[model samples]
Target chain A: MDSVVFEGIGKRYRSLWALRGVDAAFRQGEVVMVIGPNGSGKTTLIKCLLGLVRPSEGTVRVNGQLVGSDPAYRQRIGYMPQISQFPPALTIGQLLEMMRDIRGLDAETVDDTLVGALGLDRQLEKRLSTLSGGTCQKVSAVLAFRSRPSILVMDEPTAGLDPLSARTVLDQAAALRSNGGTVLITSHLLEEVETLADRVAYIEDGRLRFLLPVKEILQRSGATRLAQALPVMLSNSATP
Target chain B: MTKVYKYTLVDLARNRFVLAFAVLMLVLAEGLFRIEGDAMKAMLSLVQVTLALVPLVTLVFTIVYSYDTQEFTQLLAVQPIRRSAILAGRLAAIATAVLMALAFGLGLPLLVHLPGMVSLLLFAANALLVLVFVALGTLLALTQRDKARGVGIGLVTWFLFVLVYDALLMALMFALSDRPIEPWVVPLAALNPIDLARIAVMLRVDLAAMMGYSGAVYQRFFGSAQGILLALGLMVLWAAWPALVAFRVFRRKDL
Candidate 1:
């Protein structure tokens, strides 16, 4: 069964439709990279799945449960937002502890893989306001992975990180995939998409243009690289 | 909800804004008490100051804080936390922090100088004003997505409640001076939360005569237990209605 499904999802903001009839599904043990231009509903689609934005029409199902009022389904999901802004007054340790408490996880049982890997344990005393953009991103990455979620949604997860940190993040996502966790990522980095994505979900103009495998995209476009194949695939079938 | 509230309260406490407000209140109230040299007189003076400052500070702070925590709100929204919890937690924390400041700044002086029913009433009035304005601020913040616009609206809202509403009422009273406007004026005064708070405390201190016609009208109309109950009910409603509406708005709101 699909771990997540967006069935004919539609979201309209006043006169503008931010997302219209967006239908897609992510199977377990696969990383689906959501790709799109700016304001093309990539974030909107992810927000809809996370119940951050309510759809104007249609339903979303996760683990066969309908997404609406109950937030229980969110427990199994981890999200790393593109913008990393936490309570500036809080130390990194306090923020992490708060998240752990909210999730009702014992401190002893909490996962510290990301914290250790990102070197956040040492800087846990630092206030969020004092951290640089890259450090904040690392903290966000830690929060997303600390919960050991079955489904991961990362929006521009590597936009601000140094190359090494970004590589670590991609590796973590890969590890999650190896463990049969489903990952949904949106990125402008086609290179990262090619390396990490099992299926590429393309969205444009508030609609899902295509959701194809990397190999299928390369084969259909007769191109050796995903960067070359994306344009060909998009142009060939503009209405998917 | 408790976890969110706990974290938010801790965050607010750690931030200097709440503490600064607390210290300012303490100094002001302490200075007033020292200068006046009379507990009743100091409490009376504080009534006016609290009535103005509580709403203005609460309005501006809540709106600004809401915008500041938008990203954190997103993080919470993706967690297992309900939107209502998120909304309630933030509002509660704002109220708690502001109320704490009011208590330390104003409550301490009131407790030390004037330990009476009137001082207690003034404290309650300040607490209620915090609730009303915080709710209004939450509404303004949620309705206006842009931070500058939200804060702008908050200022206008404060102006309308604090100064404009009274000015309008005074104008209405003057225009209708020839007629007995008590019947209409009573409900009109009740419409503004600030007016309601002022009247409640003003009447408790037996300073209605000093409040001019509006106070006399309220004393005559709301002097009875039933009328006071009705006023109290209205004040409670003032605190709750906006918060309830904001909660609904937040639930339906797309983050």
Candidate 2:
């Protein structure tokens, strides 16, 4: 069974259709890079999959289970939103402690790898509001990886980070994929997409424009690099 | 739910705005006691102060906090927690923090100086009032996304309940003074949660006259034990109904 499935999902807000009759499946243990133009429903599709946005029609099945109304269903998924801001009063340590309690994880089970790589231990006692944008993004990335979830859904995970931090994040994400975690990621960074994706899912104007393997996309576009190939793919899809 | 409730409570307790309100309550309570000298007189003045201010602070603070906490709430929404639990935890924590500020800021001071059932009733009424308004504000937040508009709605809601609702009710009663509107009194009072709380506290504090002609009519019905229960029940329903509405909106809301 597919790890995630969106079956005829449609979302509309006051006549503005965010996603319309969108159907797609994320194969088990495959890295699917969700690429799309701004406001083309990429984020909407992702939110729908996570049950943050209820669909106007149809359903989402994750590992053959219905997505919303069940806390247990979310335990196997790790989500890193494109933008996240937590309460300023909480220290990083406090937030982590809260997360641990919420997830019912043992205290000893904290994922030290992401924490160490991000150097969050040094900043654990600092208040969340005191951190800079990139630092906050680092905290969000680290927290998403804390539970060793079977699925990771990330939105622009590397957008705010410095080059070195971005590289480290990509390295960790690739390692997670290698360990059989199914990832549904969205990014505008073509290099990150090429390095991290096993397949590409492109959406435009609330429609799935293309869902293709990296090689096929590259071959069809007649370009070796994702940055160059993306334009060709988008142009080819735009014609009809 | 317990974990979320704890963390949220801890977070709100340390909120600088809440802390400032806490200090204001403590100072006011202490000053009012000194000014009145007599505990009963002081308690009466404090009751009026709390009744006006609690709803205002609770409503405005709640709407602002609710607006500000959307991002974090979104984070919690995606967590492995039930939708209802997420809401329940946050509201419970807000209510708890509001209650703590009330108790520690004013209740503690009054307990030390006056140390009577009147002070206790004031505390109880104020606590219930905060919960009711917070639930109301949370519902407003859930229904409306625009921060300015939500805050505007919340302010108007506070103004209506604390001041205008009673004035309008009294005006209606005055317009029909010759007729026997006695039958309409308790039910009308029951319409506003703040009024329900006021009646509950007033009856206990021996200020039935302040309630006026309708107060005299209300005294006949709410004076009874059954009426007291009804009043308390109405207040609980007031707090609960909005919470239920917000939860329904929340579960179906596309954040």
Write down the TM-score of every candidate. Answer: 0.96, 0.96
lDDT of 2 at A215: 85
Q: Residue B78 lDDT in model 2? A: 81
lDDT per residue for candidate 2 within B85-131, as digits (tens), equals 99999999988888888887998898899887767767877888888
TM-score of predicted chain B, candidate 1: 0.96
Interface RMSD, in order shown: 0.8, 1.0
Assess each prediction's global lDDT (C-alpha) against the native. Answer: 0.89, 0.86
**Model 1: per-residue lDDT, tens digit, A1-240?**
599998999999999999988888899999999998899999989998899999999999999999998999999999999999999888999999999999878888767888888888899999999999999999999989888989999999999998988999989999999999999999998896578889999988898998988788888999988889889987898444
Docking quality band of candidate 2, CAPRI definitions: medium
lDDT of 2 by residue, A54-132 (tens): 8888799988999767768788888888887888889998998898789889978767687878888899999987899
